[model samples]
Target chain A: MYLVADINVEICAAKSCKLCTQYCPEANTILYSDEMGKDQGFKYGSAYVAVDRCKGCAQCVWVCDNMAKNNAIKMIMIDQLPKAALTDNITYGEKSTTAVLASPVVG
Target chain B: MSLDYVKFSNGFEKFMPKEYRDMVEHGPFGKKVSVSQVGSFKEVLEEHPMCAGCAMTLFIRLAMVAFPNPEDTITVGTAGCGRLAISQAAIPFVYGNYGDQNGVASGLSRGLRLRFGDKPKDVVVMAGDGGTADIGFQQVLHSWFRKERFTTIMLDNEVYGNTGGQESGMTNRGAVLKMAPLGKKFEKMDMVQMAKVAGCAYVATVVPNNPRRVESVIKKAVLIAREVGSTYIQAYTSCNIEYAIPTDKVMEDAKAVENDRYQFTEYVSEEAKQYLTERYGYKEFLAKPAAAIPNKA
Candidate 1:
C-alpha cells in the first residue's frame, strides 16, 4: 500500500471537496477529517488517507492532481514513511487515531 | 543457451517492458535505426522535475534525440517551467535570464564559430511561450534580425504555467488564468508572421505528438541554422496543471488544435533551401505533406 504522507495544505484548495475520496477504489482508504480543516483555518474539512489500506494505487493522488488540479496529495512509497507515521492523526471511524489511516468503504 | 533462458527471451527482444522495448526497437523518435546510428551516444537526460506527464518533457526528449551530435551541442534555456525541468538535462545547459536566451545563443554562436571554425557546433535555445512572446520577445526579434546562426525553440504551453497560470501573450484570447480572471483581453501574438517580418531564415510551428515531423523539422532547423541563418520552432505544448486536466490528456488537447482554431505553419527561406540542397542534397525542402501542418491562422 502507498502512503499519502504529505498533504501540502497550502496547495490544496481545501473546499472539503471529496473527489479524491469518491474516486478511491478501496473503501475507507481515504477519510474526510475536520482536523486538516482546522490546520488550514477552514471549518469544512479535508481528506486524509488510511495509509495501511491505501494499496498504493494512487487513484486519490490522480484525482487530486488531475480532476481537482490541486497538488495536495502525494503517493509516497510505504517504505519511505517514518516509524511514527501513523501515530499523529485521528483516522476516521476510530475513536482515537493520529497522523494517517486508510480503509476501503463498501457501498 | 539453456532451454529455460530460451523460453524466457527472443533473440531480438531486449526484455524491457513493452513501452521501453517499443522506444528501443523503433528508435528514439519512432523510426528504425541501428544502435550505432542513434543520434546521441547515450540518453543525455534520464530524469526531470517537471510535473508528471508534462508535454515539455516530450518535446525536450525529442529535441535531444534529433540532435545529430550531442558532444558539440549546447542548449540554452530561459525562465519558465521548461527551464525549471531542464536543470537536470544530460547535455550542457546555460540558464539565461527570461527572454535572454536568444542573446545567449547569439553570443554562443559567435564564440563557437570563432573557436571551432569549420567544425559544426549547435547552439540551441529552449524557452517557453512567455519567454519568446512576451518577456524575451525583443531580444528574440533582435537576434533574428541579426540573423544569428542558431536554432531557437519555443515550447509554447500557452499560459505562463510556472508562475501560477498567468496570462501570457501566447495564451489563447478567451483563456482564463489567474491574471486574466475574465479571459485575456488581446488576441494571441502571431509569432510566425513576426518572425518572417524579422527576417528569420526558417520558422515552423510543431506539435510534440508528431514525433516524425518534430525530429525532421528540428534536425533541418539545426542544419539550416548552421549553414544559413536563424530558425524558430514553436511547439504547441499543453499545460495540464494550468488547463485543469489529467496529465495524460495533454496530447489529446494538443491534437485537437488540428481540428479547429490552431494551425501549424512552416517557412524556410530561399537561402536556407539552397544551402540544404547544396550541402545535404535535399532536393525538395518545402514539401513535407503540408496538409499535416496547417499554414493558415
Candidate 2:
C-alpha cells in the first residue's frame, strides 16, 4: 500500500502543474477523487494504479503537477513466496547497478 | 550610450565603487524600474536560452544556481542551453548538440563508463521539449533501458523548432501552438510517468520558479540519480517567444497558470507560494518554474 500524507493517499499536488500530467501516456493514476478521505478532501484525490500496467518507467511521478515534497504513490512487491535469491545485483545500465530491495535466500 | 560604457559603470559600481557611489538612482517607490541583467533584451534571449521564460526555467533557476563546477566537471548539452546554456561562457567544458541528442547521449554514456570505470562524473543530456519529445526520445529511452549512469533532463518547451514552431507530443492540450491549425487540443504524453513505469528510479519533479524547493529538489534529484542509478529529470519549460510574451509578464503568467492548474491539492496545499518561501528561497520567484515535472510517486 502507498503511504500518503493525508486522507487522499496517492494524489500529487503537481497534478495541476501540467508538467507531467499532460505528457503521461497511461491515464491510469487518479490523483484526485471526490470521496475525499481524512485531510485529503476535494483538493486531493488518488488513483489505484494496476501493478501489471505499471512499466516501472516512473512517469506518474515525473508527470506530477504540484512538486509535492513527499511521494504519494510508491510500488512495492506484496505476497512474495520464500526461496527467492537472497542477493541479486541487477545492473540496469552499463555502469550503474542497484540491489533488489528484498530477495529470499536460495538453497 | 555605448554598450561598453553601460557595462563598465555597472561593473565598476559593483566591484570597486563605494556603496554611496555605486548605488544607481533608485526610482520612486511605486514607479517601475527596469534593470537589464544582460546587455540588451534580444541579446539576453539569445545568450541565455535556458534562462528565458518558460515553465522549466523554474527548475533551471534552481539547478543552474546550485550545481557547482558543472563546467569542467559535469558535461551537458541541449535542453536549449539549460545547464549547458547558462554555462557556455561562464562555465566551460559543456558540450553542445546540433541534433540527435539521444544518440549522442548514448555514446557519451557508454564512453563515460569506459573512461571513468564507475568513478562517477556528471554526464547530463539536456533536451528541449521538441528535441526530446520528437528528436531525442529514442536515444534517451535506449540509454534509460540500458540503465546508463548519465542523467537525461527534458525541458518541455512544448513546441517544435530550431524552425516551423510545430507542436510536439509534450504540448498541453488546447494550448495554442503557432502552427496548430485548430490550436492544439490533443493531450500531451506523460513522459515522467512513462519514465517511472519504464523502471527509472530516483524520479522527482521540480519547478525552479518556486526557489524554495527547486534547489533542494534539483540537488536531491541529481544526488539520487547518482546514488540509485540513472534518473530521468523532466520539468516544466516555459515558451515566451512562441506565446508572444514579455519576460516579467511571462514570469507572472507562469506563477498564475501553474498555480491555478495545481491539482493533487493534498500533497501541496498551502499555496505553492508559501511553500516556496519557507522551504526553497525567495529568489526562486525571480523567474518562471520549469515546464516538465517528473512523477516520483
Candidate 2 is graded, for docking, as incorrect
> What lDDT is reached at residue A82 by model 2?
22
lDDT of 2 by residue, A38-100 (tens): 234435322333232233334334333234434554434423322111112221221111223
Cα lDDT tens digits, model 2, B1-297, are 111222335455656432122112211111221211100010111123343334453444335443422321354565453443445322223454544665665676567667767554455666677766666677666666776656667776667644556778887788776688587768887777666666565455544344435445545445444435556666655666676655435444555655755211111112333434454463543447767787879
Per-residue lDDT, model 1, residue A70, is 79
Alpha carbon lDDT of residue A41, candidate 1? 76
Best by TM-score: 1
Which 10-residue window of candidate 1 chain B scores lowest in summed lDDT? Answer: B33-42
Residue B203 displacement (Å), model 2: 2.0
Which parts of model 1 have CA positions greater than 4 angstroms off? A1-107, B1-42, B286-297
Report the C-alpha lDDT of model 1 over B1-297, residue by residue, as the tens digit: 111221225565655543233223222232322222221122334435567556776677667767766556789988888876566644568999877888988999999899878788889998999998899999999999998999999888899899898999998888998767999988989998888998888999888655667778888899998868889998887787888766545555667874565566789888989888889888786556645766688
What's model 1's TM-score? 0.63
Give the per-residue lDDT of model 1 (tens digit) for A1-107.
43443455545435555655444433333545555566567655555655544444454565567667777887565655443223123322222112443322212
